[model samples]
Target: MDVELFKDGKRLDGRDVEDLRKPLKLEVGVLQKANGSAYMEWGKNKILAGVFGPKEAIPKHLANPERGVIRCIYTMSTFAGLEDHGRMGPNRRSIEISKVMREALENVVMLEKFPSTIIEVYVIVLQSEGGTRVSSLTAAAAALMDAGIPMKEPIAAVAAGKAGGKVILDLNKDEDNYGEADVPMAFTKSGDIVLFQMDGKLSKEELETAIDYGWKGTEKLFELQRKAFEEEYSEPLDKKLRMVE
Candidate 1:
């Protein structure tokens, strides 16, 4: 690895082991045509999520008479990476991520309210620097809320891992590639873990530590999710006045 993942007390990005990248930005209602949409930028990662549905389920057979079905599609642009050569269409990795993303949001959605329908979430990674799954999930949750889907609570996700034998919160590209382990987790606002995936090895103690860090990171993420909604609702007076003018 060209970058020193951990040195003295900092990683390649000069953040302490547990510190997430700053200036995580989120915006909602970016797409006019979609039922709802959201955009997120975390460090170098940029992703967009759009939600459509509670509409009729295509193919007919996939619809559940008792509850709505959630479908999630995650895609990475060919130029999303530092290189410009990713293949188009759904690959195995994206397919698997889409499945997990669907499950994470499915639990919180009040699907029973819209029987025989489908709620589709499309996540597009415009740029990537690691932890795209978590970023995508975060944006997906926001998009669902923006779509006015009834939900128990918003979901938040984060990645925590072992680096230099220490459990750290939020892994950037270098840390993820060079670190000893990476654990990505998602939770509801009430702290229910809806998704968890681990890559690499970790001892029992390290695993526990990583989970704790993951929860803490998700708590922060949940706050950001709420902040996005607040900003969405709180239109500035200047903008309103300009509209009036």
Candidate 2:
């Protein structure tokens, strides 16, 4: 039997099969024309998100009389990758992602503040090496803050992978694809998880371990998000908004 060990009996690029790489970067207020926007890069995964309104609702039926409504659109950019499909358009995958994202966000935002208004969130996946959903969630939260939308709390999301029988935090592309399990979690800065998803099979113990990794990773991400949020408020953002990311 030819057994290719990931890294000395661990998964490839090992750090206990679940240990993730460092160097996560987030940029807030990237789109000058949008009411609020942000970009996030986690390893090779990249996502750009924009938040618009509390604007007057469009299509009379879509309007709500008691609370503001949220509409989320998620799409993949053409240049995100050329390895497989080259075309870009609304597909089943994008539709499902958009719906889930909207549900996740609507849970925390204060919609009652803007009744009869619409809050639009657009997430464009620039790269989808791994954990794109988590990245989108994190980016959306940042964009919402930039737009000055009041939320119950800031949400931070991260993915955990189990490789070589070990749980790792924040899986990159290869780890996510080849790993035994993938678990993504979204949480508030206060340590409350609001959204969770899992792929592949896992024992109860394994699931707990994955959740632990996700929580730790989310905490790490929260600090970066906070810093980004503060920088936007410190001064007027230039075109590049290249001040202290």
Candidate 3:
């Protein structure tokens, strides 16, 4: 718990503070049963997200008459971490994450357009290195878009921190476990902050630096999101165009 996280002015993984782990991949429409779906790999984390509903809200009394309700179900597979992989069902941590994630997505989705229904988003972490929550947010956003859910714009998230006396852009598992402060943030394409959470503490100046890195990181996440959509359709679209030709 007290090992040095930096050496030679670089992270233990040899990344500069602003570097996101390489091989950050995103794909969409990976789940045939869901209305929309996406898969993401960030560092060692692997996540899948699926969207369903905007369908009739069950138990009519709980349905919102003015707008659709956003329900985010965030879960981790038993094998998702370095732990024993024995837990099942919604644990306290997953329940809390699901609540916060639901709030974050509620901001981007134009729920009012679908009135009196439910928009359920399911995000499952298949593996974890760290920052799974923010990665889940990114995948869910893409899945929602894949489902053709109306949104003001795409949403993306990233985790940054102050570690080993430097501001770090993305925290892998080791950094998160030992860092001075961990800050995870979600943002819209236009730079509006949607969700921000912090653990540990930081001076105001350090906090500002983390936020700056967080926003920049989200910009990258948003671009990958766009590519997920293109990856989902480009091949099929090319065949259609060839047929037309």
Q: What local distance difference test score does each model get?
A: 0.89, 0.82, 0.89
Query: What would the per-residue lDDT of candidate 3 be over residues 1-64, giving only the tens digit for each residue?
Result: 6789989888899999999987799988888678888899999999999999889988787699
Off by over 4 Å in 3: 237-245
The list of candidate 2 runs beyond 4 A from truth reads: 1-5, 9-11, 14-18, 239-245
Report the backbone clash tally of model 2: 5
Best by TM-score: 3
**Tens-digit lDDT track of model 2 for 34-150:** 889999987777899999999999987899999999999999888785376467788998888788788889888999999999999999998778788888999999999889999
TM-score (all chains, Cα) for each model = 0.93, 0.90, 0.94
User: Regarding TM-score, does 1 or 3 come out ahead?
Assistant: 3
lDDT (10s digit) by residue, model 1, range 85-122 = 45869999899999999999989999989999999999
* Superior candidate under lDDT, 2 versus 3: 3
Against the correct fold, how does model 2 do in TM-score?
0.90
With candidate 1 superimposed using the best TM-score fit, by how many Å does residue 110's alpha carbon deviate from the native?
0.7
Q: Sort the predicted structures by TM-score, highest score first.
A: 3, 1, 2
Per-residue lDDT, model 3, residue 103, is: 91
How many clashes show up per model? 0, 5, 0
